[model samples]
Target: MERDAVIVAGFGYRRGASASSLHAALALAQAGHAQVTALAAPGDKIALLARVAETLGLPLFAVPLSALGATTTSTQSPASLAARGTGSVAEAAALAAAGAGARLLAVRHISPDRMATCAIAEGPDR
Candidate 1:
């Protein structure tokens, strides 16, 4: 892993999802990938993501709803589109929090329980 690289892991989870669910999703998305420097999620989900960030010893970025809705994602989900006006919550959050010129390392990954999703993004500077 490049220590200087800025890699962000974004997550989206259903209400009542356990911390393990988010961790599982993140682990799946991060397998064989660079180390995650940060975590992000929609503003409404920030509190939930913050717990994971704290456990991982990483900062958490709270992406605005408008920004999340505006971001384009590699994977499209009808449920996410209808609820958040984005294709994928995890992907949108990752890109939005990664700042301008960010790109996804891969498509979003879901937890085994199917209650959470995660996506990784790297900033342009990386």
Candidate 2:
């Protein structure tokens, strides 16, 4: 069987959030996907992103705030807009990191603790 294309998981979280929160958000976002090629988030969240990446064993990509503005997301959040000038940071980061021709495979999903959110975007087939 042919392997599936890479999926990028984008995350957003509050400062001092735990790695387990990120892991839960990622697991919920991934659904049934066997693996994720990368993890992405805003530049300021590098520390948390790095932790999540290390836990998942995936490469990490930091999405700039400028690039995030142009991303079209399936959902909108006032809090994200107020903080990042975008409706959904997770969606925007996933789309931005996935590069051109990317589309969201999963919309933003918040963790049980509500400390983190995650979304998945599929890049063009390799």
Candidate 3:
């Protein structure tokens, strides 16, 4: 039997919040292909994720920056991460999950906001 895949994209509402997760969870939910989503930087990613989760009535803990994928192309700076509500999103995710009494799942931040969706769909180690 074949198994579906998961695609985590960078944080963004490009595809609209209502459909983002659905599109992200697509592959496995219906077609049994892959579950995908857009991941983003720490500062904005956390709130963005939380907002999205809230809108979807899902509990979201933390969203990390490093987990977001390589940031060499990103304009975000180390200082920026610190300034953002989410510094060290990886650790924050742990903390958030702990506080929310939820099990934290590791996720990667996709990229840009446009085609980055396709990048994350490629999976990690890209």
Candidate 4:
């Protein structure tokens, strides 16, 4: 496998998202392109993104979701959510390291207001 990167963003469960972003993500995933998710997305969004990755057998690079700006009811990260309430954060991290057939990394995003949230915005493996 050549191993490509994928980023999905601008996902709003209640508000919805731009057609372009979704289309672009799907196209990129289908074409096997590297990506970095840099949107004001939430934790549930990350979980959904992970499910998409699992379905397509594609590795997803996603942000470390938090409750600071989220409006949903989730209190867990994607890794924790994926483990189905059976693994700790450390174990999940270990699994990500060992069984992670794909690479995922966290990158900092510069806001328009020049503020830093130290968020785990998704990025490509490139």
Candidate 5:
């Protein structure tokens, strides 16, 4: 049976973050995978995600915050927990957006500016 590919990159950023920050983070995360089929982020970060999606020429998805908390990540950040009820927004968003039977292809990676972070997730073969 042929299986469809489902790879996504999820991002988290602070307000006023620049596209360069997101690009850096995405680049780092993509090192683990050759390509990313889509991009995703928390619902409130639609504008930021859109900018990143435009820059990368990929589709963007808004992951509901309610779905974020249940995701397990390789790293944990206190600040992220306080802000979004998740240990790592990038990881959580990636898993949430990828839907059930998803796994992290890349752990969270932060940009040099510390303004943005990204992670990659791959859904079960479908």
Candidate 6:
């Protein structure tokens, strides 16, 4: 059987980000988009991201800092750059976790509280 294409949602957030913050950011990123197949974030943030993944029943990917640095993103945030060495942590995480040949479907979207950010990417058949 042919494998299905995958859509990955990646996140970046403050230290105290709550599940609500993540869900809000995800909602914005998911607007007018297909359902996400997985979730991703920096390895350090994986613990925080786990709640959202568990709620959504999706797999989560812990992208390494090296991989995040290697991926290019559409948006640039000074905070993200200074802290993570990436233009946009949400975008970089999405691209990195989406695997080779993955392309972004949506740029980063911040939560209403500005405590979290999310981006979406679509990858080749899994």
- The regions of model 6 sitting more than 4 angstroms off are none
Which lDDT tens digits does candidate 2 get at residues 103-125?
A: 89899989888999999998864
Total colliding residue pairs, candidate 2: 0
> Weakest 10 consecutive residues, lDDT, candidate 3?
112-121
lDDT by residue (tens digit), candidate 3, 6-119 = 233333333243345423532222233233333322444455455554555543334444433322222333643654333333323332323232222333233323211211
Candidate 4 residue lDDT tens string, 5-82:
434232322224333333343443223333433333334455544554455554543423432222221234454345
Give lDDT per model, in order: 0.90, 0.86, 0.34, 0.33, 0.88, 0.94
Which sections of candidate 3 miss by over 4 Å?
12-44, 56-63, 67-120, 124-126
| Residue pairs of candidate 1 with colliding backbone atoms | none
- Order the candidate numbers by TM-score, best to worst: 6, 1, 5, 2, 3, 4
RMSD of 6: 0.8
| lDDT comparing candidate 2 with the true structure | 0.86
Specify the highest-TM-score model's number.
6
RMSD of each: 2.4, 2.2, 10.1, 11.5, 1.5, 0.8
**Candidate No. with top lDDT:** 6
How many clashes does each candidate structure show, in the order listed?
A: 0, 0, 19, 0, 0, 0
Which candidate would rank higher by lDDT, 3 or 6?
6
Candidate 2: give the clashing pairs.
none
- What TM-scores do the predictions have? 0.94, 0.91, 0.30, 0.26, 0.92, 0.97
Q: What value of lDDT does candidate 6 attain over all alpha carbons?
A: 0.94
Q: What is the lDDT of residue 113 in candidate 2?
A: 89
